[model samples]
Target chain A: MREPVPEKTFIGIPASDGIAIGPAFCYIPAELTIPVCAAGTVDEEMTRFDMACKRARVELQSLYEAIEKRAGKEEASIFEAHQEMLSDPALEGKVRAEVEIGETVEQALVKATKELASLLAGMDNELFAARALDVKDVGHRILRILLGLPDTALSAVTETSIIIAEDLTPSDTASLDPKLTLGFITAQGGLTSHSAILARTLGLPAIVGMGAGLLEKVPSGTSIILDGRTGEMIFAPGGETIARYKQIKAKRESHLLSLKAAVEKDAHTANGRRVEVTANVGEAASARDAMEHGAEGIGLLRTEFLYLEDTQPPSEEKQYHIYREIFAVMSGRPVIVRTLDIGGDKPPSYFPFPNEMNPFLGWRAIRISLDEPELFKTQLRAILRAAVGHHARIMFPMVSDLDELRRAREIVEVVKRGLEVASVEFAGDVPVGIMVETPAAAVLVDVLAEASDFFSLGTNDLTQYTMAVDRGNAKVSGLFQPLHPAVLRLIRQTIDAGHAKGKWVGMCGELAGMTKAIPILLGFGLDEFSMNPRAIPEAKYLIGKLTDEKARDIAGQAMSFGTAAEIETYMKGVLALL
Target chain B: MAEATIQVKHKIGLHARPASLFVQTANKFSSKIKVRNLTAKVDFVDAKSIIMVLTLGVMKDHEVLIQTDGVDADTALGALTSLIKNNFGET
Candidate 1:
């Protein structure tokens, strides 16, 4: 007689969408322990070291080629740097010095690599610290080859399965095969972690931050069902539960297929009201992809990537070239470039940020831009130069009051004047807008509209500020609802106020692409909706199904409700009707 | 011997890809090349060594003194100086 396995359920933060049902491949990485050994004569040890270096070089060359083929040259450049480090004369000399002192080859390699890693890690800069990790990775790879260990644990996965791990490193993520790796469930990581971002990029369903106990509950080869959209996971599911999830998976796939089929159609209500559907793109490649998915324009082009990677701010020419690349991709479509939004959680290595308790509410974004006039002018000049013969608009972020808007505009004027004097060709009539993220901005939209060309509601920050909930904090994450009545009221107010002043209002947030919120936003008279590139097709398809009058009625009924839960339930009912 | 004192204006100083390029340039000559971080008051290290150049902790706007000695010392000095002056061709 055999006993059946009991069903177990776990919840985590949803990092990507779609459904996955397969056996669990619990990935526990094997740790390498170096054996203590006596050193051979210097000549023999040197030969051994040379052989290992040759092997490591060959391994890195193939790895670089593979990554370049799968990802791109930019991604494979890391391996190029690693190859340089492996052959570095200084690193080699250090190891040789250690071996001459009677240290074993393994010990010499470890000491030399650690010394270099520490030198980089000792720097106060974050970029150098990240480099330290790269050095450690390269060192470990050679160490494994020397020890005669297998390449990696994930390489052994030959069948289709959902991977469950504590967390996946960059190397672990690089090794994942899209065919065999169905999804990922990690015991740790937030929505913006490396693994989570990689999962979304790979179009793989993922749920993260399930806590440390997830690994204990899920053994290898356990039957698993996961919904990345709902962050629901079931282990050792019974037959009934499996059947139910299978239906959900089939329905979602069919729905996606139908939406993608209508990707070329414009987003228009049944009443024939046209609303621009766009994308919030971070780079040139995403901008091109957004256009291919029928994004009307780029509603939000974040300009932080250029500054985040380096130890100092990118030069004016560098910023110009990058902005031009994106503008060229958009091909005369309206591209609203949001100025550098940093500080808070995204402090760059070059800039010294004040240690504050409430960084979100502290000196950030427009505040930093205002204080650093030279840096602000550099970015403004670049944007102006890049906008030549292109449909480019500049938008400021995190503006709470009219003064920050005035001061920023004044600097723009200064940059324009300087460009004219210096004979620099630039677009003179570029529209300047403000992100209505702060409560103060939303409330004073009409007053601020007098000085601004347009308004774009940044609902993510607006919701966080209105609810006073940190979206990243798992404890209060449930409260960070963008569809809440309070947030809806703010959105409604911003749209109406902007319209009254003859300014078009747009929304570039997670709420914009949400299926349940689109109809209500349409009723609220939002001129544009911008979200992730992946969500554009579905949002457009849904918008084409509703009449303006019915959408207004839904919005009106939603407003009558007092709480977020009530509004959410009401929206779900309305969606079912559609 | 040939030498030059130049400020590193590359955004990330003499590190990452820039450091690698610097070492590659130094290795093209038969001259013995060494560099010292004047701003950090660090001693000179072999310029052909990526790890040695990085250990100088040179950052943006930090002045570095480069010295080269051999038949190709002048050529090495010219190339290194031009590389630093051009911001390592990064822009």
Candidate 2:
């Protein structure tokens, strides 16, 4: 007799960084399929296909109209494109051709849809690559119609647990409850997939591309240990592995507790150079979490969340109340409120934007705000009003040129004038800042520095735009490199530009939280670093260890590199020395 | 067959709403319309297929050859040329 070998471990790509030990919550989205059946007569199958197409069109139309009413015109346009894809003659012709060859209606539709999706997926461009998702979305609508199945519900994740799935679509990612989701392990996806990006945005541990058949091999409710930073997974761990993971988790928790105890003190480098540590929060509730994690104040308070999942735009009073609530929680600490910075791939279900080939480089952020002054003024007024009794500042996203910044300032002036005329009490002199997220802005940092009160380098968009890599596209996701020499050089240049003009600069992007980038950022004389709440203590700990002189030398050496890989390898060398 | 080589004047080239509008216009004429993206030097694709038209990956300043044959060849060719010249209604 021979003993059976246990399958206890798996390796996957590290999509988000962290560690988690939780009960596995295997979420299987209803597979796209049709009942097994023989090929019907050609006319009958075509009629069935046509009926499904019509139903899908109606569903997509309602979706478009619904999204347009509240979220705005840009978000609603996605459904319009989906509707167009449904009525595409090429797709219909292919499905009909398949039916003529004696295939069932379901089989022909699935085959045709998949072929188009794969074709788009195979393209090198991000726009075409994104189109693949839309194709699959339309395909699933048709498939769901044929299968008579309801939509998969991800909203009911009420308990904290790790999610294990084959893959998650963008819609599934959107529905994920960050408060309840501990982490995610998917069998298929790259670092830039929607699921991965969602994990990062929500500050959850995740590993993707873990290989197929994970769902079948690993049962639900199984105890699992996922090390997202290391991309390792342990299933049904033995006594020693469990003990080791528990010990590590305990040590990490205690370290965080100690860091939280020291929350009131300002962070300074070994050489006594002080830097502000803040948190980037999405909602009013997150202000408490940020304080708990030792954040001095809110650095980037995203106001866009109030605009989503609603039937209409949040009224000024509603927005004012919410902002006041967040301000009350902060207790006079500075909260830099960012206005609705939506467009491109980040649109909600409701806005309408003209179809553009390269959305990332198209109308978005302050551009959209400038175009719609009423919408922009409402947000500015709310923020200005909130600052009346609290420490608050206004920061605009994606200010690509001097003209855009000047125009934004003009609007602020108008809003201030309106407030004064009405005798409304508000913080009129609250500093105005613009996010240098694009190369054009980065290049014009010195000029922008003179006009603006301060600067915050949005490293996420800066990295993507500088590298020309769409972070949402998995195929080129790896190229969304923040450590590239060009990105580092740009940061260094922006910091210098800000300092030379006597303007303080801060960073409130994913790069600010990355441990690997901290040393260089610290060396670059960055005045502030704001990030997710959970990453604060670790960043503070690392900052406490490095001398300003050492960090500057390392940053200087890093800029001389020719490629991202070389810089990465050198960084690892520097980390080892530290 | 009637044909004309036109430079796509739209700032974003022949994609998105422009591509959709181009395909919709081509479908209106009673002619078998085909297009070849000059930069990529690819084979002709059915001008009426929005999906296929997007596959060309044409950009602003790229040249494209539109060919039409049948009863409304001249009309179709003339309309497409004007569409390009007008920058697909883009300012």
Candidate 3:
């Protein structure tokens, strides 16, 4: 004689698009506790600590192997470093000294790790601060072993269920079992949080920022239905609501299947106009993934990753090999490699950047390259060397005026001459392009196009600079709209200018993949569209349905709209009709 | 005992992978090595200990005094100085 659980519904932000129906697995992690009494003698405590360290090392080895298989070696290196820390004599020596002084093993270990972690945390560097977290994580893992506590509660999920937690850490998301873990619902986090991004990357249905008291309300094992597309969650739903959701889920799955089936097909409009749908990638693995998803080429290959975590600038040989691997993966498909777009938000560890009041508007991108000619030349030399027998092109980021472009081109000429003097083999006919991101660059596209081989509209920065809104700041984020009439006008102007100069125009921004923005960009006669690999199939499918004449009409109407909101609504209405 | 003062020119100083690499290299020879951050003006701690090396807080271009007392002190100093000079083989 059990009372039926009452049906309830909760709304949250839709992070990833999908439908999931499953019982809730309320994940409440067990905290490790230190024993109050010192039960073991000094020698006995030392032995316990030693045994725990040994076990932790074995666990780290396995974790490293698992992570290496799941997410490449670069990520797995963290565990290897943790293993080295566990073997550090100083850490053990500190613990042994504390244990000899009458402190318990757990207490001694905590004190030692805290002291070491604080030393790192006190540094003014963000990378060291992040390492402090790693030190703490390793200490906690050993402490769990010493206390005989089980691993994270996530490992206990044995059945298919929707995970409910306050929030998920990077480690939690990384260890999520794809088969048993259907999706997740979090009481905290925004769309761009680490968990949300990981969920999207893992293709999991997730709804975040569900607010507080969510854990207390939704008990474990309660049958719940969630739509990641609409961000709706139903708890203990009624029969009718369940049926309706089931139908929606079926229809959505079939639609997704159809999109996947047509992934290899070229993007062509109803009026027989063809457009290149490419992908923006950072590394070789992503380039391969993009190719599998039917990316015609790599429109944007961001080169910042090679310089970010290193203790020094990557040498020309190292850069050459890395670029060569990516070129081999792309297999003759054109790759537009953007040279060292560092500074501003992404200052590399090796470089000493001046503290600036306005970093974005200050010395960044091409400015940094032009100032540091040696660093710039090393990268250019690598690109040119790696471009041999590969369809590789070079593109510059954050070009504002003609002076910067002229200097950059002159440097390229210098590098080419230097390579020729050294008898180095390089592709001499590589096309050089400029990213029309700044208002100055967008407005002067005609003049810039004459010097450049092609133009790529970086709408993300275009919107930010044009709207005078910082996209990262929540208060002004609403004004950071790409669909705004002003941003669209800039895009139209840039495309028209590039065409007038007999140069092809491409867009390598988030707007390029958006279903609503595709028709408008098509109407503007953009030659190429580059976006996230996952968005390529749907973008191609949508492009196939729109005629050039109708798309131009829709673009004309969209351009006539006053505000971003009006344009957004109009685009959504237009998308529904197709 | 053999001692030498060398500037740690690695970008991130003695931290993370560099610290681990420094300790691993020091542990190679049968030398009892100790290092102190001359810039930070801290006491010399065991160079073979990653935690001790990290606690020095040696930033880029910070000078560190290394003292090795054992059979292979000169070799250890040469190896350590070369490692620092080469930027921990990160290039």
Candidate 4:
């Protein structure tokens, strides 16, 4: 019996989003060329070399200036050396001396540059040795000018293709034209690497850190599917797989058109039950974008970003102006402002937050806010001041107990009293909310809902705390499932309790943005769905397709499942139907 | 005639920009400057030529002798020695 053809699917770190299907363009490093020519007049050859050098000089200077503008001075300095190499008389004289002999201009330039490059390459100092590449680059530029050849490399990508390379340096990634290049599949790089960042900026699908051996295993010109979503590189994919990818790509393209149309439309169910799809903005700039993307309101304006970059906390006036600017753009639309949920991953260096072995479970969010009442009062006063003529609401993060909620509410009253005494003409009776992230808070939602105006389910932290799995820790990340039975139970209980007390519940977490989790979330009677601005259109599209009854049924069915896998698999089937 | 022995203190040694900077400095004076790689025991070459200077493969900790033969030879020697000692301002 013959062995079946082995599957050729390679796994890599997904660096950018999107699905790309194209022929592989193997990036072979360009080699310096020198064509042998019959001896022309020595003066003619000399003049040609000089003209080429002059042009090369101008080009290198322009390149330096352009690099300085794009990547800054440090990167531009590399081309400065190239420009100086143009002025190197020893190199130029050797070429002219060769031209003085029988050799043509191209031959002389190549010979002189190669000799110098080889000398540099043969050196023991690794830094000096790398100069060989710089010498070769200068030589290639000048030779290409003389040879009447187009600058290749990036421009060489004539047809639509995926770039398969051992690794791409910042320079290589910078040279790629997004129009011609379909995507990037490099053998080495991380998600945060420059190659990945550049690819993302250009909207090119990218997968990195596939290991260098991947280049040798897959030859150039082979049809491959680079799924950046799943970080899979499938070589010579079967007909079904190709057809499926084509369908997905086509659907995505049309989906964009549909989303653009839906941008101005209300996000609602087929039965006409309106779902308020809002944005989780970080700054005034992002708040404007949220409004443009048809966010009914700002769902979760994380206030931590204001204090993150600065050494000192922002003044009340500074904070008030920022909040006012963001709220002004919303134009009476509701904006839920979450208080500074700093500490854990986002500990500002200036803030003397004690380092803890288990920060996520330790003092963070409301714990810090309650301890530092002065900081809390300043933020609250700013929010109250900005709330004038705007539908503004304040929410506290990591509220685990009724005392924490009451203490935060008391501070809000103190700040409001101060603002009133100053006759600051601010909004009174601003509704206060709390994030039900801790399991204790979720369980006591009925009691807390009475004290709180609303509840925003921070499912990300809720899952982390509930599962006792540090989501940041990769080893146990698989266990940190938002859809796990335990997390789902908490979410269901919180929503029920909030509604029972006549308060609306909203979710502003990774789960809220997930299309797969929408059916269950909508069924749980979630009043508001908040997420990244980019996810609003799709969220609206999916929400419009779902009915209240079907969503409830899906949620009810999901709750019956004992494990997250069961719910996930069931959702996959339901998603396929949709 | 003026001569001075200097060590290549630049972290990257006499490569590219540093070498270009050295050559530019050498060309500022009317002095005919020549450099020899004492570490490699190579013959002295024109210090004003970047390619010849690079060819010497002068690296970090490698000693070199800069000799000048002109009216401003002493000034050239002082400037070149300081440039090398200062690591071409890279460090």
Candidate 5:
């Protein structure tokens, strides 16, 4: 058996602001159920109902007064709403009328609870329906307290007592001491729910959907950590996790201090080479985010997302208009547009293709284009039509063999003919490229480089295929090593082959953002590394510190690792040095 | 005038969304459209009464007669033939 919690304990996503340490104890106000004395006189029963109402009002008003005095006018606004709900005219009238008709105070409370629940539930809004449960819970609590029964409110015990419950209504939240309650736990809440939004606004660490039996395992006053980003929980965290976290926290503070200095300066490496940090977006609406995030230009403009919202093919004019918007935001900086890589995992339901035994390795991406010649021709023509007088480097996906590459070129030629006949003002040199995802394509890069102007290594699929492990399959998921020697070898070979054939190569994958892999990729002499926008600053931070010479040394060391854990430890040491 | 009884080669019959799209294509042409599931000649474009087409829900390899008469009836027959043969992208 585990030792009793000496300190108050809480494990949750931290929300609400400020930090205060206090004695660990949970205040479980017992379920308020009044005993039914049915044989009492009618006037006596009415007296009992009035007594209950008086007691509830006094307790509620005391809460309102305390919040108003302590939190001031603005902070106390939430309590005013809660106070209104508690003292609602219809609510008091239901209890009073029930007692007059020979019902005991206990019976009157039960009746009022049901009627209130029904009235609220009848409303169409979910918030209203949810409150139907809340009022009933609160009413039950009040009745139990009147009957002098033990506590019922789930005491969220933290390093002291953090309350864990199915749910806590706003009224329940209003009544609790903000200092005593560390965080909240519930069965249901999305990232954007009112509870979560409020929690973040307040900075209280909360974890939702821990399932049941959490209170039994983690008693009141257990020290714990709530990791919100990765969704991890520490039951009783050891020294290593604590120490490492402390260091990272210090690093974050330092980074914030540098934000102002970095804001005015362009991103450059330690060795004086400037690296373009651009935002990657799926839609043109996210274009402003690029500018806000200090993006030089969009690195990857995923055009496939546009084709997904509609069943019918988007007309050429529609494609042109969307492309024009993306190009317009950049002003002059280049936007690398990848064509529709459909029919793999993202197969459209409207055009249901027959189920494949192995979809990941089946007819997907460029393979779908090869099969549907007309579909590919239409998209190619649309891109050609859209690429008029704009800087757009086009790319194709899943080029495992020479024939697929040639066939893609042939369709591009078809689209170009249409544009030429239509007298469209287009950039003739909007360089065409192929994605090197398959191991075969990576190995045959020299041959591919001759036909294609550039290569974008899609490492997500390449890493999965190289290790013979499905990224989604948990049994072999650990075996799906992103930094395995086998995967790295392919990347190295592809980059070398592209450089050999007078072609520029870039990577569009998670590996580009990985801090350790960033150095390796930079050392490997990649022309560019495209990643999700958020990863830019951190990747740039590492790249800015790393020298080509140092990166090459790290790459050589990484190849010697016998296991993924060893590689991880080695990378951590490298990061520590930086 | 041209007519032919073509078998519903795709596993799912020409119904629902596929049928809706087929009817939309049919309306674009100046042809009297009728699709028969065996002997029941179903009306092409009444979306409300389209369930009658679903009621006969023809399966793969079942033959259904098509009768069309118009200026481009042959073209309609050819286009409908391709859409049905493609399994509406099932293949």
Candidate 6:
């Protein structure tokens, strides 16, 4: 077979592993169309719409059944959600009006999709927006896979993942097996898409927005590399690239394995300064996972989950019951409770809120609580009521100034007095604290740290805000370096500020959990760490082996480094001494 | 409309898993068809695609999509409405 002078292909950074080879197929989503009536009988259109809805319902049921068979009975519920959508009085009924106007099946589906998308998009709920994406995704996947030509395999290649036409839906993202599948690549996605974030959090490497026609060129099992860090893609790379990649990959693998293998008992610094490794948990499942991973306790139990999950506010009694369950399991380990951190990217359904063009910089966290004292009070009352007998601390998220800090403390004090008057045996004087996530909070750390019993730097937000890099934006993601001198300075400053006031400082961000960062945290004199449960034992092990004196030296050297890579190498060198 | 026959060059053929995909695409417009062959004509398959094209027993070199209609009739016919006209082509 004669091939044209093979166009020299560009290579990407290798993020995931494995090989693939199959007929390259690409899926380009057709823009949806909804009918704007010209002239038609409403009754006829209604009948046709009904027929289409029925057909959609039937298709959805079969899809659900198929998903159930492949996965399990529990997962079948996602499809049931689709079925419910079909019967939604507002959703299906809205489209039914247009269908009653005699829209074709194709037109009906498009109209229905846009209607639902617009409604879901408009909602203040983050979960609603997520669900809307799922609605479009599951429906789109089923429709496309059903109609696609040349039949490609949704069935995965062993050890290699199935890339997609676009980013995967939330349900699909959740269902993937981490080891057997590397993760998906898509032609249309931002770094913040649920799939992208989930993949990153799971430590599965992924790159998005490869543009269209990816599936057409990159055949499955063809020895391709997905470089998530640099956003590079290489196909049929030569031995040099492969060998260079293998060395880096092997070192990284050994690094991860070393974390697990390094697992010892209690955490301590080089000078025998003890550090407690805890997990930041939102659910019972994650709490259980934290205990499994050797977490000392839950650092921040976000009580806002009650508000996020339901159609209305969770009554104080319900909130109390949840707290009792969570704290009881801790077997007396401290559970620091953070009040409602609503608004911005995470919004409540019932709240009348604004969609900020730049959500991270918008009215969010404690700003919302300060502005709406009543909502804040109701939530505070609920937290205080629930945390009566539990190891609890009243923590606030996003406190920028002294007034906000002073006002929040006053509210907590008032609530405690109220609880005491009611003759309730409660943990009335819960340690009140604020997440030092913003630059303003870090800048005002000395004053704010004095008012609170403890400080916890949410480095995820701090890194994003300080660098002015929207981590959600791939173009600037490189700039979201936690090791940036500015960020490092704030972290060091926040820790010092907290300790100067005799307040213990901790971190519950991704930065706190990085294996290399353990030494730096030790140097910073952080007393507690909160991360995913899976990372606890590893963090504990890393911290256990470190000496405070050695860590202090490493941090000093790292801050003076030129690049993040250099800082990592410097930190790794320090860890070697252990 | 004029009809042309093409082979399935993509190897896996038309009927099995690929049929539904072909159908989903075919259903994109308002068109009608009775896909058949030199041997036997299949009548009244759901024009909505998700099932029709897949039933063609479409394998490599198989021919199908005998008839079609609607506004973009010729363009649709030239572009796609006629499916018995591909070889999954080699570049």
lDDT of 3 by residue, A1-578 (tens): 99987888899999888889989999876767787996478999999998999998998888778867876675667678888889888888889989989999999999998988888778765555546656677788889899998667488898999999987755566678988988999997778655676677667899998999999989899999978998989999988888998999898888788688658787788888889999999988899899989898999999998887566899999999989999999999899999988776778877888989989898999999999999999999999999999999999999989888989999999999999999999999999999989999999998887679999999999999999989999999989999998999999999999999899999999999999899899989899999999899998888888899999999999998899899889999999889
Better of 3 and 4 by lDDT: 3
lDDT of 2 by residue, B1-91 (tens): 9999987866577766788789889989989999998977867888987777777778777899999999999999999888887668642
lDDT per residue (tens digit) for residues A355-398 in model 1: 88999999889999999999999999999999999999999999
Calculate model 1's interface RMSD in Å.
Answer: 3.8
lDDT of 4 by residue, B6-65 (tens): 888665678767888899999899988999999988789989877678878887778999
Candidates in order, interface RMSD in Å: 3.8, 6.8, 3.6, 5.8, 21.4, 17.3
The DockQ-based CAPRI class assigned to model 6 is: incorrect
Query: For candidate 6, what's the TM-score of chain A, rounded to 2 decimals?
Result: 0.57
List DockQ for all candidates: 0.34, 0.17, 0.42, 0.27, 0.02, 0.01
- Model 6 error, position A331 (Å): 1.6
Q: How many steric clashes between backbone atoms does each model show? A: 0, 11, 0, 0, 53, 32
- Candidate 4 residue lDDT tens string, A134-222: 67778878888897876565777889899998777554665777677889998866775556866775668999999878878778888
lDDT of 6 by residue, A235-351 (tens): 666667667767776666776676665443556664678788888988666676677677788887766776765546767776777777788778778888787877768777777
The candidate with the higher lDDT, 2 or 6, is 2
Name the lDDT value of residue A276 in candidate 3: 91
- What lDDT is reached at residue A157 by model 4? 80
**lDDT (tens digit, per residue) of candidate 2 on A1-578:** 87633538999999987788888888876677567889989999988888888998887777667545644564456667677777788888999999999999889988998998887787766555656776787888887887776655475466888889888765565456667777889998887665676577566789999999999867888888888878999998877888898888777667656565546567888888888889999877688889888888888999887776353677888889899999999898888988788876666556777888888888888999999899899988988998886889899999988998999999999999999999998897899998889999888999887669999999999999999998899999999999888998899999998999999899999999988889999999999999999898878877887899999898888888898898888989888776
Which segments of model 2 are wrong by more than 4 Å?
A1-264, A344-351, B1-91
Question: How does model 4 score by TM-score?
Answer: 0.63
Report lDDT (CA) for all predictions: 0.88, 0.83, 0.87, 0.85, 0.65, 0.65
| TM-score of candidate 3 on Cα atoms, chains taken together | 0.68
Docking class of 5: incorrect
Q: What is the DockQ (computed on Cα atoms) for candidate 3?
A: 0.42
Residue clash pairs of candidate 1? none
